[model samples]
Target: MPDISPLLALPGAVAGAGTTADHYGDLVAEQRMLAAGRAIVDLSDRGVITVTGPDRLTWLDSLTSQSLATLDAGQSAETLLLDPNGRLEHSIRIIDDGVTAWLLVEASQTAALAAWLDRMRFMLRVEVADVSQQWATLGQLLPVGSPPLVEPAAPNGVPLVWHDPWSAVQVGGWQYAAEDGHPAAEFPAVEILVERDRLAEVGVAARAGELPVAGALALEALRIAAWRPRFGGEVDDRTIPHELDWLRSAVHLSKGCYRGQETVAKVHNLGHPPRRLVMLHLDGSDALLPGHGAPVLHEGAAVGTITSSARHHELGPIALAVVKRSLDPAAALVVEVDGVAIAAAQQVIVPTDAGATAGVPRLPRLGAVQRPQA
Candidate 1:
């Protein structure tokens, strides 16, 4: 949101044009660069908040969805800040450096989230500051097929990095995505902190072929293909982590009390999420792309709406949608884009049966005292 025009005016690159792109001319080439893990994306649209104080870690653990009280230096985790009524309010990508906890959030949420955190620091030794104006965000992928998990080293004197944990379930975390061969297992994503003043330098270096640079568009396509959940797009005020399969990495099931923890436990253990997430493989052979909020239909009835849709180089146009949990998994669906119906097939990311103790016994109905004879 700062004066990034200088960065955009560099040669051989196309302007981002709002909420998309930081690419160097060719979209396909930029996408290839990202998929190969050879390019960095200028994710400056994200914001950073710094939490400094002795009580930072413990205080965060007591208020968020993830357990952070024992987190060590340079470690990463994703946590959700839910309302008291168990609805999502914010999702934070977090990492600590023993002295500071850096929270990476959407730019729109930066100041608001920081202000809220400050207000909640009653009688606590914690200080929250929106550092987005001082720091920027950059994204890159870890080495493909690397056996050991890698942590991103600070770049350009910026000393924080938050590695994405969506690739697998963390200890004490629950996974609502019941499908076999989850696509995120291969999404080796990492986000790094960078000084704001280095933006033009990065753009210049990228233009001179000294460093590879792509755009947010490429990364988003891969994210959709991988079925990753994101804030502002995949989430809303009514969203619960279980609906997005976010429990896999963000919610620690056995963590001590926090806002919305009761709803998380009850939904996972005894009740089912009211809705479910699914990947829609759209019929884009017609070159039609569906926009966000496009209706997803089954037999002429609107069952859901497209949250995020993208045209990946390899996968073409694909989308992620949230539909009623009772919608039949095998039912053929359609997405309406520009008044044309695009046929879609459901890839069961979160199955209808997703929940803990799904097979647990249930009590008999109140009016039925005895079993009826067959």
Candidate 2:
């Protein structure tokens, strides 16, 4: 199994579970149950960081792209950390519990994000710590029953539940998708924090069928179906928020200056992103799904590569890819998987004219003489 899931059966998923956690033995059923809000995803392997003190909110506001100063307690917000040139460096899922702001990130991002925050705190009264050792995370949809089987509690007085904000655009955000039929509304996901010591308890409950459990495979498929963009999966060195339709939630266009703000602003106000995100519906006749980094080709020429690929229970083989913004939206394409070319039809997520939101008009050329009205 790989980092995603045995649920996907990408390479060895048919034999072993993927890299993260348990395979749960029944991926199909897991997908069905999880999508229906009857199951929970085991995300204990992810990372958790905490920011403390009175200046935590204000300090964070000055550093990240989102307006965090006014973030209310128990509220969910997503923000991006980009380089000076506006390329994605980190994606932070934030939930402030009044006293402490809990930063949920991929396990691989814990050390780097903590270190960056630590170095940026000059005189502000703030403290950052990677508390993954003490805390764990679990994901699920809104409860199917009247009452949730597991209630999230904050032992430290800060509520531990972080409702996902990807279901809709956030304040000070912009959306680039030209259509309104996005399935994001179907993904009412949330993350809950629990003490690491409770993992054994949760496992026992799951094993006894008192609660349902899912794996990365089941969870990721639902994400693809919703056309959601993730951190490590959908992001790359050249990635900017506009390219992924990430501005819908992870970016604040009007927020004051932060690292990469210039590029974000310029791209949205005067230019289009170099690349755009799209969902590829792969041919499933072979029952073989392309893995990450698989080549997307037009006329046998490489145009882009698949970021994340999965075999969705309902949608079959699907993937997210970043292709040239100039690629024709209606052009037929193909994805290469393990030396075989799989037919792929694109479903546009971000449009070619995604940016230039400011609508700046073009000026006449400097060397060209002004012409009279024809």
lDDT of each: 0.82, 0.83
lDDT per residue (tens digit) for residues 44-102 in model 1: 77788999999999999999999999998888999999998788899999998888898
User: Superposing all C-alpha atoms, what RMSD in Å does each candidate have to the true structure?
Assistant: 2.9, 3.6
lDDT of 1: 0.82
Candidate 2 deviant stretches above 4 angstroms? 1-19, 143-148
- State candidate 1's TM-score: 0.92
Please name the candidate that would achieve the greatest lDDT relative to the true structure: 2
lDDT of 2 at 208: 65
